[model samples]
Target: MLKTVSGTGLDNLWDDAKASGMTESDKLLYRSNLLGSDKRVTNYGGGNTSAKVMETDPLTGAEVEVLWVKGSGGDIGTIDKSGFATLYMEKLEALKGLYRGPEHEDEMVGYLPHCTYDLNPRAASIDTPLHAYVPKKHVDHVHPDAIIAIAASTNSKELTQKIFGDEIGWLPWKKPGYELGLWLEDFCRKNPEAKGVVLESHGLFTWADDAKECYELTLDTINRAIAWFEEQTEGVAPFGGAAHPTLPEAERRRVAAALMPAIRGMISEDSHKVGHFDDQDAVLDFVGATDMPRLAALGTSCPDHFLRTKIRPLVVDFDPANPDIDGTLDRLRGMIEDYRADYAAYYERCKHDDSPAMRDPNAVVYLVPGVGMITFAKDKATARISGEFYVNAINVMRGSDAVSEYQGLPEQEAFDIEYWLLEEAKLQRMPKPKSLAGRIAIVTGGAGGIGMATAERYLSEGACAVLADIDAEALGKAKEALVQRYGRDMVRSVEMNVTSEEAVAAAYADMAVEFGGVDIVVSNAGIASSAKVEDTTLELWNKNMSILSTGYFLVAREAFRVLKAQGIGGSMVFVASKNGLAASPGASAYCTAKASEIHLARCLALEGAPEGIRVNVVNPDAVLRGSKIWTGEWLDQRAATYGTDKEGLEEMYRDRSLLKRSVLPEDIAEACYFFAADTSAKSTGNILNVDAGNVQAFTR
Candidate 1:
C-alpha cells in the first residue's frame, strides 16, 4: 500500500514486492523512476541518481566495487540501464589526490574517463563526484520545487534549520564539481545524524545505505517541505496577490495566436523557431503578479532552470482590460531588440576570459500579463521543455515569496554556469541540427496519402507539422500515428475545410499558436471528377474548382500572411496534377481545376519573389497506392477510359510511363520535400513532373 500524509503530500510509491526480485542496480533505477515521476520531486532531466554495487571485473574475473550514476545528459525519469555510467569506486576515490582545490575543480571532469569501470562508453556527468564522494551506497541529487523553494529563499539557511532542524543540513552555494563533492563529504563527516543536505540556490542531496531508504528519504524530505508550506501559508495570497485579471480561455488563446506569429518573425532572423504556449494556473498567477517584472528580472535561482529558460524571461506589455493585440504587434520588434541589447550587455558584464562567444540573444521564455507564457526554441520539444522549466521556477517563487523573501542567483554566478567551459564543451558535442530543424509546415488534406506522406517526410527531417483536413476521423488517426512516431510536440491536427475562408484562417492561427509561425505550406487538398465537356454539370465543375483552385488560394493567402508577419521567407508547394499539364479525356472538370492550380503557382511565385518566398508545383500522375482519390469513383472512371478494370489501371499507367514504374505517394512526397527544403532554394516557379518519365507532362 502507498503511504501519504495528506492530500497535498506525495504518495510513497515503492513496492517491496517489485523490488524484492531485482538486482541492486535495477533497484536503484526503479527508485529513480519513482522519484522522478512527480515534478514536485524533480523536473525533467534535472536530477541524477546513483548506487554502489559489486560487479565482476571483465579482466580479472574478480568482484569489485563500482559506482553507477546517471550519465551526462540523461534524464532519470526515462533513463534505462545503459544510460548509467559505470566507474570504479577506487578510481573515483583516487581522483581526490589529483584535485588541486576549488580554483581548478573543473579539471577533475577531465580525469573522470580514467575512472571508467568495465570500459563503459557512456560519459560520466560532472555530478559524478558529488554522488560518488557521498559516504552512503545510494544517493540522489534532485531539484524538487518544494525543496528549492526553501533553497532559494533569502532566509534559506535559517528556514532549513526551522523546518527539519538537525535532521537535514544546509550548505553555501558552490558550483557542482569535484570540490562540491568534497564539500558534501565533509558536511556528512561533521553531521553524522543528518539525513541529507540542501545546496543553497541549487538542489537537494539525499543518501542512505539502501536504495529504498534513500528513495523514501527523498520523498519524505520533499513531503515535509510541502506540508510545512501548506500549513504556514494557508491564507496568504500567492505572488502577493494577482494584480491583473486573467482573460477568458478563448480570449487568451486568441491573443496568443495573434502575438506568437509577430514575435516569431522578429526573433527568427537567426533561425526558425517553434513555439509553446502555456496557460497553466501557476503561470497565470505569476504573469499577473504585481512583482512579476521584479522577480523575472532577478532571474531563476537554479542553474538547470536558467540553462533552458535563459537568464530571465521577457514580460510582454499585454493588459486584459484593454487587449491591444495590434498595438502590441507594432511594438513587438522594438521590444525584442531591447531584449537582445540587454542580453548582450549581460554577456559583456559577466563573460570570463575564456567564455564562448555570445549565443542567440533572443529570450527563450516570454511572459504575458493577463494571458500566459510563450516559449520558442529550435525545436518543439525544447520550446515546450523550456516552458516547463519556467513553470518550475514560478512554483519556487510562489512558495519562497509567500513564506520568505525569494532570491534569484547572483548575475555573475548565473553567467558563469551559463557559459561554463564544461557546459560549452558538452554543447559542442551535440549532433548538428537537421535541415528542417525549426521549420513549421501546414499540410492541407493531411489525412490523405500524399499529404500524410509529405508531412512524415518533413517530420523525419525535424520539422513540426500541423495537419489540416475536413475528415475529422481520418485526421485524428493521422495525427495519432504521427504523434506516436514523432512525439506529441511535433504534430498537431486541425479540422479545416480549405474551401471555407474562415476555416483556412482559423487553421493558420492554430498553427501560429502551436508553433511559432509557418515556414512551408503544402496546398494538396483536391477533388477529382470525370465527365465529357457536354455531359459535365456546372455543379461538378464548381465543386472541383472550389476545392482544387479556391482552396489552394485560401491556404496560400493565409500562409503568405503569417510568412510575411514573421518576415521570414517560406516555401509553397502546390500539388497539381499531370493532367494539368497534359489534358486527359473524360475529365474536363478535374483537368481545368488542376490547370488553374498550375497557373496560380506561377502568379504567386512572381508576387512572392521580392519577399524570398519560393512558390513551386509538383505534378504527380496516377499515385494509386494509399491514395483516397484513387480509391473512389475516379479509379473506375480512369480505368474505363483506358478500357481496363480497377486492378489493371495501375499497370496501364505504369507501363505507359517511359520508365514503366508506378508513382507511389512517397514519390510525390519527395518532390514536395525538395521544394520545401533549402536544396531548391535557388529555384522557384518551376514544375516537377513525377509520372515515371511522362513525356506529355514534361515541363520545358
Candidate 2:
C-alpha cells in the first residue's frame, strides 16, 4: 500500500474505499487531479490525461471503447468530468488513414469533433492523437519540472538511459500533433517493456493498462528524476553561484512598485495591461545569477513554457549594487523598443505562407535583478501564470545547467509551435473582451454598500480593483466577498483613510505595484449629517468637510499623479449626493461639503481634459439599503428631521422623486460604471443624477 502523507513528496492519494464505487472515468479524473495538485508532477494546464473505457453505445446496445481525454484549454487540477472530451476509440484510430503527412497534421484537429462520443461538446485538444495512438488503457503526459530538466539538458537521451535505464525511453524533438503521435506509437511498439518515454526538450509520457498503475508509474518516474537530480547536483551552486545578492523583502517590493507601472505604461500602447510581481526564492536565484541572461536569451525548451511565457523574458537594466530607479526608467523605453524590433525580426524570419499575424510583441515576462520578476498580460491571472511558468523555466535551467549544458528549443521550432495555425484558431475562438477589460480601478470606501457594488460591477466587466477603506474589518469582509465572486486575482484591498494625504499616496503606490497602474478612480468615501445651521458644531462641520470634501480632493490628487506617470488618460468618478446640486434644509454641514465635491470635480475635469483624463460625478439620494451611514445615527437624524420613522423615510423619499421610484445601491453602481467605461469617454465634467428623477438635482 502506498503511503498517504501530505507534503512528503507526491503521496499516492488513491484510497481503496474511495475507488471502490467509482467508474473507470471517475477513477481517471481522481488520478488526474492528484497528479495535477502538485507542481512537481505538472504545471497548470501543461498536461493531458486519458483513459480508454468501455461504454454502451447510444445508438447500438453494444459496448464500444471510448477515449476520454482532457479538453483543450482546461487545467487538469480544476477539471471536472465535463471538461473531458469523449471520442470514439475506433473512429480515432480511423483518423490514421486520413493523415497525408506531417505538413497536414493541424487539419487532424478539425476531424476530432466528428469522432465525438455521445455528442460531448468539449473540444478535443491537439494532443488527442498523442493519447489515442499510445496503445494503452490509460496515459499521463505531464511537463514536470524534474523531468523536463533532464529532457532539456544537452545530453538528454544519455541521461534518460542513466537515470531510468530500460524502464523509460527517450525520443527526439518533434512538435506535438498527429505526426508526433505516430512517433510515440512506433516508439512504444519497439520498446514494449518500457513504462514511459521522455520527449526531447518537451515532457514525460507514462502509460499503463490500469488507471491506478498509470498514475503511480507517472509519480514513480517523476520521483526518480527528482531523486536523481538531487543526488547528482547536491551542493552545486545554481546558476553560477548567484552573481548578485537579493534585496531585502521590503526594498524588493518598493523597487517592484516603482518599476511595474512604468513598464505597464510603455507596453500598453496597444492596450492596457495588468501586472503580477513574484519574488520567490527560485526567481531571485535565477535573476541574480550570472547565467540568467544567457539562459533567458536562449528561451524556454518546453512547448508549454514557451507558449505562456513567450520566447524569452526581458532583463531589466538594474544593478543590485547601486539601485538607480531613475536610470532604469530612462533606459526602459529604449529596451522595450529594441525587444519589439527583435520580435518583429523573428516573425519575419520564421513566417510561413499561412502563419498567423504577429501578436503583441511585448515580452510577457520581465526580470529585474534584486527586485523580482514582473509579468504583464491581458489580465491579472494571465500575468501571474506567466510569471509561474517562467519560474518553472528557471528550475529546469538550474538542474540542466548543474548536470549538463542546458539547451532551449531551437528558435525556428519554438516559433513554429508559437505561431501554429491550430493554436491561432484556438486564440481566435476566444470570446470578445469586456468593455473594461485590462483596466485597473481603485475605489475609496470600497467596504460600504455602494463602493462594494461598484467594485463588483467593475470586476464583472474584467477590470481589476483595489478596494480602499478606513474600516479594516469591513474591508476584509468586502475583499472576501469580491474575491469569492471575481477571484483573488481581480480584487485587492488596502486600509486607507482618504482624509490623509500620506495614506492616499501610499494607496496609489500599492495599487501601482499590485496591478500595474490605475485606469479608473472612484472617490466615494463619505459621511452624512442632518444638523441645522444653529445646531451644527464646529467639529461636526469640519468632520463633514474633512470626509466628504477633503477626502475627494486627496484621492483625486493622488490618482492624477499616478495617471500622469502612466501617461494613459484615466477616468475619475466622484460619488457626490443630490445635496451637491440642490440645497437641503437642516443639513447645512453635509450639504455644503457635498456642494464642494461637485465644484472640485468640475475644476479637475478642466485640468485633466488636456491629458485625456475625464472627471465625472454620480449623485445618489436616499440610498437606504445596505448603506453603512443609513445603519447609524444619520438614519435616525434624517428620519427625525423629515418627521418620519426610518422605515417611512425611504417611502417618503421615493414618493418625493419625480419618477416616484426608490434608488438602490446597484442603481448608483450602474451610473458609476458608465462614467468609468468608455461609453462616457466624450462626456466628462458631467454630473449623472441617479436619484430616480429628482428634478431639483437635475443637471440640465
Candidate 3:
C-alpha cells in the first residue's frame, strides 16, 4: 500500500513565509519534497515535478502563467524553489505548433533557454513541455517501482486499465518532446475526467488543480495497481520456494577478499577510470536465486536504468570458497568476455546512426551464493545507484511475474530511447571532473587523524574513499561524518586488522562486493616503538613489526593481487618515516619496521611495474599536528630523546630541517595523491620525502 506523507510539517514551511508573501511555488516545493524524499516513489534523480503558477511580476505589473518544473542536475527530494526552472507557459505551449516530431528534440531544447524568465536561467528538465501541455495547475511524474512493475509488464495496457479504469489514460511510447507534449495535450483534452496517465514503458504522470491532490493521485493510483497485482497472485511463493542462501558475514568477507581483486584485475588495465562494487542482502538473494539465470536475462524494466546498469548484468558462476582463486578468476574472465560478445550482438541488433557504441559490459555482475551481489560502475555513487536499480528491478519483475509474465520495452524501443538525444542530454548535465572522478581509494587507519585527512582528500576529488581501520566504533563515526560531505553512498568504512591476512583479504573482498575493486592503497596503518636496541623486548619488536611492517605487507600485497587481477595498473603508497632513512637513536623497533616496509615497497614497485601497477613510498617526518601516531607514549619518547618537552622537540625538528617548517598530514596526502593519480604516470619505485626539507631523507 502507498503511504501518504503527513501534513504535520506543512505549516512550518509557511510560518515565516506568510509574513513575506509566499508564492504558489513555496507550496509546490513542499509537495515536490514529499515525493522526492521517498525512494518507493522515485529512485535517485529519476523523477520530475511541476506547478503552473499565475503570478503578477512586481516590476512589470503583468499577471502571467508560468511553469516551474524540476531543472536538470538536481534531485527533487532535497531541492528547493531554486531547483525549479521558471518558464513562460504560453511561450512553451506555442512550441507544440512548431513540432514536426521524432528527431527534432534538439531544436525543441533550444527554445527552452529562450522561454526562461530569468536573466541567468537553469536548464529545465527534458520533460518541461509535458508539464506545460497538461491542462492542470499541478503535475507530478515519478518512476515509482510499483508503477514500473505494472508499466514494464507484458500486460501493462490491460493491467493499467484494470487498476484505474476510465479515470486513467494510457500513452504509447513516444520520446519526450514537442510532439509527445502535443499528443498528451490532445489526450487530456479528450479525457478531462482522468486523474492521471500511464506512460508505456516509461513512468507515471498525475495532475490536478492542487499540488497535494496531484501527489495523492499518483500514490493512490499506483498503490491500487500494486494491490490488484498482489491480489491476483494471492498465496504465491517467491522463487517457487527455492533456497538462495547467503554466506555468513565473516565468510562473505573472506570471499570478497579474493574475488574483488580478481574481478578488478580482469576488467581494468592502466585506466584513469576507477571501478567500485556494492552488495546487499537483496542483491545477494536475487543473484543467488535458483532462477536468476533466466530472471536476469530480461532487460532493464525502465530506460533511465540503461544510463547506469547497462542493458543486462553479468552473472558469475563461482563459489567464494573456491580453492583455486586464480583458476576461478580465469574462468570468470572468460564469462565476462562472453557477456561482452553478447552485449555487442544485442547492440548490433538495435544499431542505428545515433546508437552509442557498446558500453563496458560489466556494469552489474551477479555472484553466486557465497560471493553475493556485485554492482560496478565508473564511480561509487553510480555503482551503488545502479545496484539499487537492479535490486529494485529484480523485485519488480518478480512481483510482475507472480501473477502475469514480465516484460520490458522491446529491443528497438529501448535502444532508440537509450541513444536518443533528449535522454542523453540529461546525463551530460553534470559538470566535468578530475581524472580521479571514478577511482576507488582506501586509507588504512582512516578513522581519524592522517587516515581521515587522506580519505577527505580523495573524496574532494570525487574518488570513493574506503576508510579501513581496526576500530569499528571510530570507523562507523567516520563514515557517518563523511556522508554529510560526499553523500551517503560515496563513503564506505570497513573494519579490518591490516596485519591479519584473513581480515585483510576479507576487507578487499568486501570492498570488491561493496565497490567493484581497489585502485589506490595508502599503507598508513602502523604503531610507534621506542627502546634501546639492547633493551628492546621481543614484545616491543613484534608490536611495531605487526602494525608497521607486516600490516603494510598485507595491505599492499592484497591490493596488488587485486590490481594484478584487474590487469589495471594502480598505485601503492607506503607511509614510512624519515627515521627509516636516517638512524634515530632509541627508536630501534619503529625505525627497523619502517625500513623493512620501505624496502618491501621497492620490491613491490619492481614487481608491479610489469602489470602497470606503480608502488612508491612517502617518507614524512615531524608531522605531530593532528596525528594520533605521535600521541601519549610516542610523544613522551620523542621529547625524552630531545631532552625536552613535546613542544620543544617539535620546534627542534622543525628548525633542524632546512625549510624550518612543521609538516602536516595533508602535505603527505598531497604526495600520495600525486603518485596515485596520472600526474606521475611514468614514475615508479621511488620515495618522495615530504619532511619540510630533510636533506638526508630526500630521494636522489
Candidate closest to the true structure, highest TM-score: 1
lDDT tens digits by residue: candidate 2, 1-700: 2132212356677788887889999999998888888777777788999999999999998999999999999988888999999999999999999999988888888899999999999999999999999999999999988889999999999999999999999999999999999999999999999999999999999999998899889988988888888888878889998788789998888888888888888899888899999988888988999998999999999999989999999999999889988899899999999999999999999999989999999999999997889999999999988888888899899999999999999999999999988888889999999999999999999999999999999999999999999999999999999898989899999999989989988898888888988999999998898888999999999999999999999999988888887887999999999999999889999999999999999999999999899999999998998789999899999899889998899999999999999999999999999999988889889999999888888778
Task: Identify the runs in model 3 with alpha carbons over 4 angstroms from their true place.
Answer: 1-22, 103-106, 239-258, 270-291, 318-328, 354-358, 365-372, 425-430, 471-479, 698-700
Q: What value of lDDT does candidate 1 attain over all alpha carbons?
A: 0.91
TM-scores of the models, in the order given: 0.98, 0.98, 0.90
lDDT of each prediction vs. the true structure? 0.91, 0.91, 0.76
| Winner of 1 and 3 under TM-score | 1
Give every collision pair in model 2.
Answer: none
* Model 1 pairs whose backbones collide: 265-566
Q: Candidate 2, TM-score vs. the true structure?
A: 0.98
| Residue-pair clash count for candidate 1 | 1
Residue-level error in angstroms, candidate 1, position 485: 1.7
> Model 3, range 257-279, lDDT digits (tens) per residue?
56665666555543433444444
